[model samples]
Target: MNNFVLLEYAAWGISALLGLWMLADLIYTDRTYSEEMLTSSQEGDIEDSLVIDPTQQGGQK
Candidate 1:
């Protein structure tokens, strides 16, 4: 019933909670998204769609 024993139990409880959360998240993601969709390369395509121009956005010249 010392402070160290209480701290150790708290640490174990946090660890168990984190592990269960990660497991649930993994299962949810696996069931919601396909492997190919998760692995698709859409970063560049999204970046190319943006118009980055301070002048056109009403900024000082």
Candidate 2:
């Protein structure tokens, strides 16, 4: 019983450490940015032409 308890504790500690390491890795990773791909004028044009059709029903209707 004592050995089982110790093994369970060790497993819990290792799982917690791995979870923390993954969280830190996700938070500190660098995101890539590209400036030459999209300009302000293009962005505005895209926003203006975008439309949503809410009245379209699925196969049920």
Candidate 3:
């Protein structure tokens, strides 16, 4: 009976630890960028002409 109680306590401790680990992982997962940051990055790329086509530059085929 004492061994069974010890096993139960160990199982509960492991379960609680796993739940806490999962919660922490979810909470610290991604450092999401702001909308303003994304918009500014897109605008900077456009301003730099980073998406221009070489054929279009020569007035097409």
After superposition, which runs of candidate 3 have C-alpha atoms over 4 Å from their true positions? 30-61
Which ten-residue region of model 1 has the weakest summed lDDT?
A: 43-52
lDDT of 2: 0.62
In order, what lDDT does every prediction score? 0.83, 0.62, 0.72
Each candidate: RMSD = 8.3, 10.2, 12.8
TM-score of each: 0.63, 0.47, 0.48
Report the number of the highest-TM-score candidate.
1
Residue-by-residue lDDT tens digits, candidate 2, 1-61: 6999999999999999999999887666533333453232343444453332334433233
Model with the higher TM-score, candidate 2 or 3:
3
2: Cα error in model 3, Å: 0.4
How high a TM-score does candidate 3 get?
0.48
Over the stretch 29-58, how does candidate 1's per-residue lDDT look in tens digits? 989999997886555554563444558677
Question: Between 1 and 3, whose lDDT is larger?
Answer: 1
TM-score of 1: 0.63
Residue pairs in clash, model 3: none
Lowest lDDT sum, 10 consecutive residues, model 2, at: 50-59
Ranking by lDDT: 1, 3, 2
